[model samples]
Target: MNPWEVASPCTQRCVTRPTGNEQAYARTRRVPAASVLRRYASLTAALGSALAAGTRIADPSVLQRHARCVLGALGIGLDATGPLRVPGTAAGTLIVANHVSWLDVIAVLAVEPVPLIAKQEVSGWPVVGPLTRRTGNRFINRDAPRELPRFVGELAAHLRDGGSVMVFPQATTWCTAPGGPFRRAMFEAALRAAAPVRPAAIDYARDGTRSTAAAYVGGDSLAASLLRVAGTDGLAVRVRPCRTLWPHGHDRRSLAAAAHAAVSDAVSAPVLAPRTGVFRTARPPEATVPPQLRAHA
Candidate 1:
């Protein structure tokens, strides 16, 4: 196994089943193919420029601007709400959010640029890989459960040194809002470092209505997802940060549950219902860890 591979409980089955092909087709309003091509071209240029600039630009504000520029090139608007920064006296904060699509990374960066804990495969993805590494994000190998403890320890140390981190506790992407349960492993690091946990919610919408056109679940390829996003008109991502949870008296499990509930509540609010049939009611199976691995995690 590759040393950097990460494990995830989510699979193709976790994807929400659409009512039917025709119904799903009628709901989305896609732009012309030429428009999609133009968007992709703009995105490519933006990424290239970012790569050329690379690590030379270490300022968070500059990085945030670049992220917003990338989103603009892709024709995706960002609406971030609530407190986006850590309190003045906080040593560091651990930001956790539900995973929906690959774009979640860029959207979060646009609001608050921070080091991310990403899966190893992300490091090999075209221009994005090189750019993310240059930004000093950490990658993990989920395949090696034994290394989890060391990784968590290092993360705690980083927090202790007053460095904030962003992580997707869902581990894998889901089709839409209220995705999957938060994993407890990363929460352990926050507890060890005495950092606050901030839960954020991310969802995509077309015009003013909720839309799943940007979901990257099932057997969907990155190229296919990117094209879908580019072809969609009036697409926007809404990011809402919930109240922070202190770790003074919380365990990893409790902290994880609290964060998950906060995010779920934030996203579960009533939005304009889709014109199509109802979303799937089934939930994905919970992730399981062995007793020995659980101790380290």
Candidate 2:
């Protein structure tokens, strides 16, 4: 069975900165405890509102809209550059983006309530877990490489059915780069499903400069990341949508390379410095989602 041929449903689902323009972001050197506290309170309130609205309505756009409002209250601003260029009437579109912070997900959701393809672990995260479930995300277990083919096939089928799916092909987040390297696997899904691929570049800026405060890299705890983000002023998110790519006889490897280049060209290049801030945790070789979490054909 071709991994790209599996037609199964998914079991799980799963910012920037400032300046004056430059002076808009607070210039305070130190993060005050009170400010962080206030931000957390606002975030909590926004989250509660979203959760309540989610239970009452099944529309993803509504959930995303509510979440977007809360994120703005949390002090994150959004800016979109370039034309989105996606066909409004096209059967499901595939969006591929570079992952920077956990806020990247929220940024995209705020812009559009698109469902996502995320790791199984994300399905268990604190506030994010329930939100993703409510939004109907597809979660994959990274430990089981053997299942990738079947999973890709199912993903391809979903796309073929006019269902939109978003994926972070890098599979992990990086604080200082456009992306690590584009994995070719998901590109295969586009080929199989004949879906148009849209590469989006997402960046975080503070006080008119790129900021790493939102990066959930290395030993940084979630609380620490949140506090840092809340404390930063003029934190803005920039998203650039590149030209769309069609299969057009392109193979998966070529497709992946093209998408990677398109996204990289639109964003800042990765810094060459030691990325000690972003640690790569090793997973158990056999760790994978339990049977109950996966979708059956």
Candidate 3:
């Protein structure tokens, strides 16, 4: 916290500066806090070991509650609604959601019971990693090709234990409602784990104003983004339904298609509209939804 405090550029008083602009953010750092006493109070009630033993995590929802209040006080409305459940939860599930802001995971966690599948680097982050780990987040090396198999194995073990896992298949944040193709890694991992994949689309809405960019993600700096959150309006957790996925074995195209359909099912088509603000599509142009994923109810 000390390093964050520096003399304001034009004043003698110490203040922290926001580093890593949009461009610089693309080059580094991905990944907050609170009324400490309040958080502890809430965590004790929401995430007691007994609750975790029951295969449930209570931080995201609890945090969401507090965040909603704070955002509301600042005139930032967090308007969220339906498509709140996921399948495979009874036998260990894997949730894949559209990525917009870091809060995306929190929203899913609030609704679904699962441990987060985060980037391995997050485990070493100063304050972020500590909080994440304490909340049961698992990490993988986004840059490591060789470690893929090991990662898969660990996920399989976790699922076999009837534990749910949540992953960000996009690999990067996008404005909400992009409806982009899900990544192959996430698809493949779900397959290897033999767990059902729930494609959950998440977004934020306020005063009927929905913006995919509402959460600070993509080429945004951690400090800048956090400040933006600390300074802004309320955001809702618009949860789409969970489109259930079968075990993997399909090629990348098939897997992507399956994911798209699940996500699309959760949210209506043409998810991007002026009324919808902006959409971000960061994956390959050819990625699509597979028919098998949408064959049944």
Candidate 4:
């Protein structure tokens, strides 16, 4: 029960204006031929180890540990400032992080083992796709907005069962230096399930300077990003754990704002844009509060 941790529930609010920055792009300088060769060999071996662990192991924790080792082998280092424990009540824990690049997923997974909420298309990616499913992730269809309610219901149920779910509230990827506003729809699920939102900030650096070599943004192909990342020297991913927030008395919008603020502050990124008062989906009647949280609500 740390006083600083902030956690989650859902809201029905949507963004009318686009709140993401399109100008930011991944930039990487050329490295020495020897450096690239060493990293390429390391990355190849890491990928093989990850695939073997994922296919051979059935335990989630074991698979995640192997995944973490793979990230280390690929030169992504973990720099959690404090104990990485996520705090919460009997209700489930919702772990939220800023979405910078595809590497953010691997970085978080390396730090903690939890089920992830990802887009349906990730399930079809070559080697990574099947591994994601085997690791116990839930996939949502980005094409069908109407099915969001169903997905929300499932998320709430997972929380009620005292499980932890990891999500990227930004809803899309941004450059390593910039981040988008947190979408509030997913907050409503936390509201219903009475889950705590754990905000985590992830950043990539090369030789101690912030680097965009890992950003997989606008029109950046997977192969291109991979090549740049593997060739970069002194590249590392840092995961900073922030305080957790609860959704007991607050509505979905306030909760989303709190979580977003925690992450924005942690990463030292400016608040890009506002997404308030935009009506997207009609809100359903307030869900019946559980007895444990009724007093706080």
For all candidates, the clash counts are 3, 19, 14, 25
Please, what are the lDDT tens digits per residue for candidate 2 over residues 69-161?
A: 766766777765433324542345678888777888877776656778988888999777887887878988887778898989999888877
Segments in model 4 whose C-alpha atoms lie over 4 Å from true places: 1-29, 54-58, 81-85, 269-297
Q: In angstroms, give how far residue 20 of model 2 lies from its true place.
A: 24
Estimate the overall C-alpha local distance difference test score of candidate 2.
0.67
Write down the lDDT of every candidate, Cα atoms only.
Answer: 0.75, 0.67, 0.51, 0.66
Off by over 4 Å in 3: 1-90, 248-253, 269-297
lDDT of 3 by residue, 249-271 (tens): 66646876777776766555323
Segments in model 1 whose C-alpha atoms lie over 4 Å from true places: 1-26, 270-297
Per-residue lDDT of candidate 1, residues 82-167 (tens digit):
34545543457799999889999988988888989998888998888898888889998877778888999999998877789999
Better of 1 and 2 by TM-score: 1
By summed lDDT, the worst window of 10 consecutive residues in model 4 runs over 9-18
Candidate 2, superposed: residue stretches over 4 Å from native: 1-31, 55-58, 81-85, 88-90, 268-297
Candidate 2 lDDT at 209 equals 58
RMSD vs true structure, all candidates: 8.7, 12.3, 11.0, 11.5
Candidate 4 residue lDDT tens string, 58-123? 365676567666666555555544223343256767888887778888777766777899989999
Give candidate 3's root-mean-square deviation (CA, Å): 11.0
Tell me the lDDT of model 4 at 55. Answer: 48
